[model samples]
Target: MRKTFLHIKIIFCSLVVFSSLAQSASFDCSKASSDVEKKICNTPSLSKLDEQLSEVFKPLKKQRTFQVLESEWLENVRNTCESVECLEDAYNEQIGFLSPLPLPGASASNEVKILPADKIYAQSSRPWKTVELAGLPNGKDVVERFLISAEVISGILHVVAFEGHYDVPNSIYRGSLYEYIDRHPIVQPITYTIAKDIGFQGAFNLGNNEEGERYAGIMGGTFYYREKIARNQLRGMAYKVGSGTQPQETSLLLQQWSNTFENAKSGLLFQGDEVFGELKAYYPNTPGYETIAPVDRPEVGWNIFSPIWSKSRPVLYFKNGDETIWRANVVDKTLTKIVSASDQLVIKNPTPVDLNGREAVVYLEDYILKIAVAPE
Candidate 1:
């Protein structure tokens, strides 16, 4: 396993205000990994302290156990904090301790490293994966999801993450925020993640949900995503990722290449933006079509160049939640259910010639649905 080490030493800022200098620490900005290291490098005050700490650590380096103590201080005191200010305070506290800071957190006990004081202090900003949950507007889902794990005081949906479904790690948590845009159903996809450090737990206020029910603990630092959301909405993703019942399949990858949404009463069929393949659909049985925007293109008027035959007959298909498919028939312009959602089904758009025979369906990931009449 790899290890990281740092020892903070406080220096009189006045002495370095006007002196030509070199780095006092072993590491420089070029070597820093965590966000905290970057902050120390960028800020003049923190840089001076880091350099001073390096100088102090040099003399102590001759001592057998000094390096060990420095390592302990890093894990227990420094890594726990999430902000520059918090880190600065941690350094000052360490400065008051013996040589490399007493064992754990600057405690008066001679027994260092033996206590449970070793805790991560601060950290740099973390990278997060964006998960889009659609149709959830009121922020209720977010509350419900995290209510048990963390204390959700509830203002615009605030939470302190408790160990959740082992799937989400401690280093990560949902940092959340919400707002209305373009008034299109106010489908504000609240950006959120579980906070790892205490530094991110602020910018809070009492706010209300879609129902106007007031909540508490809504914090700041989640505004970077609004522009992206706005851009998506403009491009026709009316049903955005929200805190609601999202799609079972997260495969609707947004691409400028070629994806098409066909809204026939039979259902909402979506062809993956493939210049050549992959079809998906949300049938009439699936709710929330009213939530999607319409296209000027004629419905069911698309031309099908190829027809996938189940044996001389073109097939029309519908997806049953990510898995399973259904064979469908259009009666009086409405889809009548034939075969239910199943596996190994293949379907493609019905060609003008095959429209009179039988209508069926197949579409989803990895395979192209071909529905052209077989050669006579």
Candidate 2:
């Protein structure tokens, strides 16, 4: 009888320890003082989520900007949650943003194809040599969507494309950003959520200022968002441009006016006012302001959305209509059609980059991304 009683006591102690461990969170459960902390300690699922978040957020804490943002999220989002559901949603959203999702058709086994001269439409004397970079897998939902932006920085190809799934009842759409290095499988940098109502407006560009700090500008209809890109990760939360009674209109107007410039070396340049028409520059890093001389604008018919500036020449490339890509000589203000494709396959978002010693341009033809090297 004594031995049986001792065994029963041991079992009881084991159960008590297990229960306490199950209820513990990333922090000490005994020291939990606030309501949110107490709630997290008491609930098993919340405890597990808190532990998981702690693990994921551990490495990112080294980044000072991320540390600041994490504190802000804890106070603003997590602390504000009154119920378990809200807390769960907040945790999941944060985890998703921190973790990257695999790009839809980024496969290592895919081969790059070279196109013959007849397949490319360009001037006879200056025929563009083209090669297929990567393409989406054959699917119905990915048919209509196109690549949004591409930029080559320090020999790495950075691309952003529109990804969507069309279902009868619930459709989803978002932008996917990835990098291609040395023809390897595309690496997904990060995943982010877009506002449901506004959505991504198919305009994204990455540029560097004179200081060599990289910045990304994305247009989501009424609002144009800007954020810094550091260590191949989006550093912090994106902020909207413009303010006033009609902020949305101002945002788009500012974005459109800035597209006239070739690069963001001096930051985003836009016209100050319609009456004065003086050019102004806004540096996002310092939030500083300055005035500059006006730039030569392309003729009225050119679509000035996300034009890629040539690093070697005074030329800028932009998409015109559904089938044409035009190169503008900023010195002479002459527009030349450098690429033309079938109406069924839209030519969009021309990006210029120097590959080794050769100058090349990358653009989206339908769902496939193709790079064309300028003739030597």
The model with the greatest lDDT is 2
TM-score of 1: 0.21
How displaced is residue 131 in candidate 1, in Å?
Answer: 45
Per-residue alpha-carbon lDDT of model 1 for 296-328, expressed as tens digits?
A: 112332222221213222123333222223332
Winning candidate number (TM-score): 2
Ten contiguous residues minimizing lDDT sum, candidate 2 = 205-214
Please give the distance, in angstroms, between residue 89's alpha carbon in candidate 1 and its true position after superposition: 1.1
- Candidate 2 clashes between residue pairs 3 or more apart in a chain or in different chains: none
Per-residue lDDT value at 252 in model 1: 25
